[model samples]
Structures are given as C-alpha cells and as structure tokens.
Target: MAENYYQTLGVDRHASAEEIKKSYRKLARKYHPDVSKEADAEEKMQAINVAYDTLNNPEKKAEYDQMLDNPQGFAGFGQGAQGQGGFDGAHFYRQSTGGGEHADFSGFEDLFGRFGAGFGGSGSRRQQQSFQGEDQHAKIEVDLDVAYTGTTQQITLQIPTYNAHGEPEIQRKTLQVKIPKGMKEGQQIRLSGQGQAGINGGKAGDLYIEIQYKEDKRLYVEGADVYTTIDVSPWEAALGGQVEVNTPAGRLQINLPANAKNGQQLRLKGKGIPNSKEAGNLYLIINIVLPTAQNDQQKQAYQQLAQAFNAYNPRA
Candidate 1:
C-alpha cells in the first residue's frame, strides 16, 4: 500500500498549509541524516520530503484527499475491480506476466490501459497515464525592501516527481522568478508548467511559491501594518521637537508631540505595504534614550533637570 503522506509528516489530513510546513520542518530537523544518530534517518528524511511535496501543493493534495476519502479503492472490490474472489488487477498482472514481464494485450488495450502501467500491457510508464503533472509549491524569504520594490530573483528547488518507470526521483530546477511590488507575506506567485513533468503526453503543471519577508532588526509586521522602533532622546520625548526617523518606506522628519511617553506609537497612515487600494500604515514606536552624565557639565545638567522635576514622581 502507498504511504499516507499526512501520516508520514505527522500532520492531520485537514492541516493547514502553514501547519503542514511547520510539521515538516520539525520532522526534517529531527531526521536530518548528518545530525541524526538513528540508522533510518536518511530514509525518514526522504519520506518527509516526499510527504511535504504532496501536501504542499493544493492540486496534488486534493487528489490525495479524494483517494483517502474513498477507502474502497484501497481495500476490497471498488467499482469494476470485482472478481470471483475480489482479485486485484496489479497483483494478478504481476503473477500472470511472470513478475512484471511485458504482456501483449493487443485486443484488450481498452481493458488493460485504463489504469496506467500498473495494469497496462507493454508501454513506458510515462506513456500510460496521459494526465497533467501535479502542481508544485515552494516558499521564499526576501528582504522587506524587496516587498517595497519589485524585483526578479533566482530560485532553486528539488522537485519531487515520478519518472518513466513510475519510480520517484528528484528533479533539481533553478528558475528566475519575478517578484511584484506589494507582495505580502504568505502570498503566492505562480510560474506556469514548472512543476512535476506530465504523464505520457499530457500538459505539465505549474509551480507556485509563497513569498515571505526575512526578519528585520527594527521592523515587524502585523497584518498589512508595519511597525518599527524609533529612538528619541529624553528631551525629544519631554518637549515637542522635529526628529529625523528612518523607516522601511523612507526617512522622514517627524514632529514629536509634547510629553510623548515611552512605547508610544505614532502612526504614519498609508506609508506601509504599498498597493493600489487599502495600503497599510507604518507605525513608529517611540523608545526614549537617556543621556549619560559623563562629565561635570552633563552631570550638572542632569542635576538641574532632576531639580526641575523634583515635584514629579516618575514612579508614581
């Protein structure tokens, strides 16, 4: 019996794409051949890869879901599979044809070729199943600037697929992918006919990639909004002043409000995640920095400021 990809990845059949990816990552790290001490680490890694390949693609997953939904296909007599003793065709073919030797079914072409090479008379495995290949999926991490400004990038992926003999193999592919501006995290960009190869003479499938942003030191994202920390001096927070701030969108001179407290967020509307409609906002979080009293003059200044605020209890 074929392995259930969901079980292989330790994910539920209805697991979301994100959940599937998370599980795959965990299992991959555990079974990584170089780091793992287990004897079956390499084999487990291979299975994880194959499972992720199937579950990551929407089309392929749907096909697999359909198969799983129909348990009769995996068990006894399904549709025309009925026999005197519920005999399986592939089993019978292998037995009667001398353990996979070619059998010429010239007149029974329609009968044998209906189920691909598993029951076909004599043809290359690829020539038997004339259907479009399963679509493939991959994820990419780019800098925040890449989301602001569109760019093209080269990407490589190990595409899992079946070859002419109906055996699984890895097809390494490198492609130049175009990234459009305003591409949000977890959004997908599609490339046509770049997935697994088509069976027989059928049309090939497409390749889709989920675009993500690499973590930035200062910037963080929530929904469409972007947030970044801005450092301001004690004076800048205490008194309204013009402060130069650097943001992912650009640099700007912001007017700091009087008595702006620490962790105060100043919103610059429509300045983040640019798009034609409903653009996101950029939020500047204020972080007040204290000046060091390094010398007598600075210490005296701090003393003076403390005296001026003697009536104010900061702890209060």
Candidate 2:
C-alpha cells in the first residue's frame, strides 16, 4: 500500500505549500540514501518525494483530489466535475467530438504541442531560474551513550553563502536540534532555513548534519545491547562473589560467580541503552589477571600458598 504523504512528512492534511515544502526537506535529509542508516530509508525518501511532487503542484493536487472525491466518475477527465457543476456528459462529448462548443478549438495534437511549448517550457525555465540557496553539510560527533538514549545537541554550522552566480561568501549559523531517539551513526538531522540565505526571496536550502559516534572504551554498543570486559582476581575466579561494576547508566554491584572463567559471558538484563522497546542487556566477559610478585614478603606468601595448594605446574 502507498504510504500517506502527509503522515510521512508529519504534517496535517490541510498543510500549505510552504508547509509541504518544509516538511519534505526535513524528511528528505533524514532519509537521503547517502546519509541514513535507518532500515528502508530510501523507500521512505521515495515516498516523501512522491508526496511532495503530488502536493507541491496545484494542478496535480487538484487532479489527485478529484480522483479521490469521485473514484469512478471521471474516466479521463483529469479535471473532475465536482467544482464544474454545469459540466456533464453532453459537455464532455461535445468537447471530445469536436462539436460546436469547441468547434473553434484545434485538435489534441496542436493543442498539446502549444501547451508543451508554452507551459512545459516556461515551467522548465522557472525551475532553471529557481533561486535556491546552496545546501550546507556538516558532521556532528555524538557519544554512543547519547545514541543509545537519544539526546538534543546544540550545533553550529558554518556554510558558504552564495551570490546569484553562485560565488561563495561567508555565514555562520547555530541550531538546537532534537536528535531523535534511536538515531544511529551516519544518520542525519536536517535543519531547514539554517543553511545559506536564499537567493532573492526563496526559502533557504537546508543544513544536513551527519552523525558520528564517540568511542567508548568501557562499553561497545551494537544496536541495543552493550559489551564490556570486567577484570577479576585469580581467587575471585575460583570463588565467585558480588563485585562493583560501572555501566553506562551508573555504577552497580553485580554477581560474579566464583567459578567464572576467562572469556565467559555474564549478562545483566535491562542495563543497556534505553531507546530499545525492551531495555538493552549488558554483557560482561571475564578477564583474569595474575598478581605479580613485588616484594620478598609477597613472593614468600605466594610460595607458601602454592605449597599449601600444590597447584603449580609451569607448563600447565
């Protein structure tokens, strides 16, 4: 099923032309193929474009409305009879059969040729002469913790303003963007009217911010869950007990089994990023490090313990 364009753009059904354009720009930047990591981002972008193409143009919007109002009524009269109350079958037939009402009118070929030359040419010319400002691009580095639990960032963008002939000038702008929850690396947040000033009086293009994640040494995030290594003493591995640990949320005490082996995974439920519908899990892998002999007393203590345990095997 075709998605609702207004819903995709997150606008109302009665949105004005400017509102439509603004919504489209915001969504386009969000889902643009080059920058988005969301699943089906391109499909979303295509739908947005289709909706903008249909709604931005008055003629297309009218035709689309006509079809919606009277689904089976108009066979080919792209212009429906809703607003044209006097229009009926006779008028349609007369117009189609070259009758008196349109006797002075030329055939479809000539009419279309003139229309093609006039409206199509002028539309293309107007598009060519459109006074769009240059698009601005920037990169923002957000922490992975922030990515996990969405955040708002105050970003400053420096974009080159352009003249009528597209010569570069200087401009700086700052925007407070609400980073959507669940936003991932390479995702974009578009700020409309935050780019270079428009040429003439046209609306400003946009500022696109590509997301980059800050590295976290303690925790490695993959989607919703987090992974980290926790160190334990040799004795702790032999006899498990509760240990203090640090997580993205905060420090907490968790159980570390006495028999915990190196590289063994211990899972903490609902301890990771919050954006996930279900709280993400935290995985801790055990890392055991041996204490080195530092003094004669320490070396003697280890030797006595080894003697009591009789556990030393150099090769083993």
Candidate 3:
C-alpha cells in the first residue's frame, strides 16, 4: 500500500502552504541522516522528503487528491483500499499511467537507465548520463538581529565541479545575497541558474540557501515574535518606572507599571526585526530581583523604615 503522504508529514489535507513547508523543514532537520544517529534515520528522512515533495508541490498534491477522491476508476473506494488486500493491480496501473498529469519523466528514465546498463541499449546509455551534476548544498548562519532588520551577506560556497567521470572537485565562489528583512530560520532563498551546470547544454540548476539563526543570549524567536527577559528590581515591580530595554534596533525606554509581577510581559509594537513591509513585536518578560544585602548606613535606614511599618507581614 502507498503510504499516506499527509499522515507521514503530520499535516492535514487543508493545511496551508506555509504550514506544510514549516512542518516538512522541521521534520527534515530532525531526521536528516548526516546529523541523526538513529538506525532508521536515513529511511525516515527519505520518506519525509518524499511525502513533503508530494504534498508541498501543487501538481503532485492535486494528483494524489484526485486519485483518492475518484478511486471508482479503479476497483476500490477510499476505505476499500485497506480491506481489498491493499492497492489492487488496476490502481497501480492507473497511477503508473501518470493519471493524465504530464510530468517530465526524463529523470525516471535516467534513473532506470543508469541501473539497467546490462540491457545493452545505446539509447539507455545516453540517457544514463543525461542527469545534471549533483546539486550543491550549503547552510548559512545569520545573526538574529540581521534576521529582523534584514541585511545582505557575502557568503562563500564551495561548489563541486565534476570531471568527465562525475567526480567532485571543489571550486570556490563568493555570492552576495540579499537576505530579506524578517527572514526566519529554515526559510530558503534560491538563486536561479546558480546550481550545478546542466548536462549536454541543459539549463543550469538552481542554488538553494537555507537560513539558520546564530545563538543569541538576549533574545528568543518564535515565528515572528521575539522574546527577551528583563531583570527589574523589586522596587521597579512595586512602583512603575520607565526602564531602558535593549532590542535589536537598539535600546528603548519601556514602562514597568507599578504592581507588575514576575513573568509579566510588555509588548513593543513594530519593534521586532524588520521584514519587508511590516515588523513583528517585541515581548519583554519581567523578572523581579531582590537585593540580598546593603551597606551599614543602608541597613540602618532600612531597619528604621521596617520599624516604622512594623504591621506589614508579607508571609501572613
């Protein structure tokens, strides 16, 4: 039986494009074989990639949807698939017939031809070499401040140039990329015609850059919102006062209201890292800190104040 693509990716059929992509990226990073140590990591990664590719791409998603919705063309209803010994031959044949979607099958041809060279067909041998050179991959780390403010970066990528035998030899190149404001981690930026050179005059592939955030101690990002914990003295929490807070844009004065409690949040609108048109907000979490001790003079003053207000007992 064909695996349920939506279920494999843990997304609903009505999921938005952004949600689907976000889920896929998270799963892909977790299961990627190069970084993951699980025994089944590679298989899981491949399955995730396949399922994502099917559902995220509109054409493939439509095809799958149609097949499921109109299984009457074959010998099964939707539920009939499980009870009737899995997918029947008629269903398999219909799926293989492209389901009336015209996709370029040349990639499959090359894949098969390369593995079936023993057949000794001259056509197959040519097809085997028709695949473009391997696509190059690189990850770029950017500062969180830059992600909000948007900045261009000059990055160096070592692209592999292949010899006639397809062995990779690294060639270095520098590219200036405009990182859009409000860029998020795991988001991808593509440079057209910047990937591997195509085979036999075919168009060059594309360069894909995935975004990664450098660790920042002061800020935590969740989607568009930025969070930071601010330390406030007990008096500041008890009596509202204006305090200067640091943001990626710079320091700004924020008001801490009287009676503010720990974990209280103050929102600064349009102060987050700037994207293109609008900016996200910054959330300041209040952390109340108490002074442990004071000098002799300060302690004497505190003792006098305590005697004046002896009726107060916080514990009681």
Candidate closest to the true structure, highest lDDT: 1
- Candidate 2: which pairs clash? 239-258, 240-257, 240-258
The lDDT of each candidate is: 0.72, 0.64, 0.67
Clashes of each: 0, 3, 4
Residue-level lDDT tens digits of model 1 in 174-269: 999999988889999989999877655667779999998998778898767899999999888988789898888888998899999999999999
Q: Write the per-residue lDDT of candidate 2 for residues 1-316, one digit (tens) a residue.
A: 3334466678887889988886675565456544456787646655565556557767656655655567566555443232343223223333544457554323323333422332223453222112355568889888766755677788776676654433456767777888876665677888887776654366787888888777767557776677887888988888888888766656779888877888999988877666546767889978898899999998998889889779768588
In angstroms, give how far residue 170 of model 1 lies from its true place.
2.7
C-alpha lDDT of candidate 1 relative to the true structure: 0.72
Q: Which portions of model 1 show Cα errors greater than 4 Å?
A: 1-129
Who is ahead in TM-score, 1 or 3? Answer: 1
Model 3: weakest 10-residue lDDT segment is 124-133
Kindly indicate the candidate among 1 and 2 with the higher TM-score.
1
Q: Between 1 and 3, whose lDDT is larger? A: 1
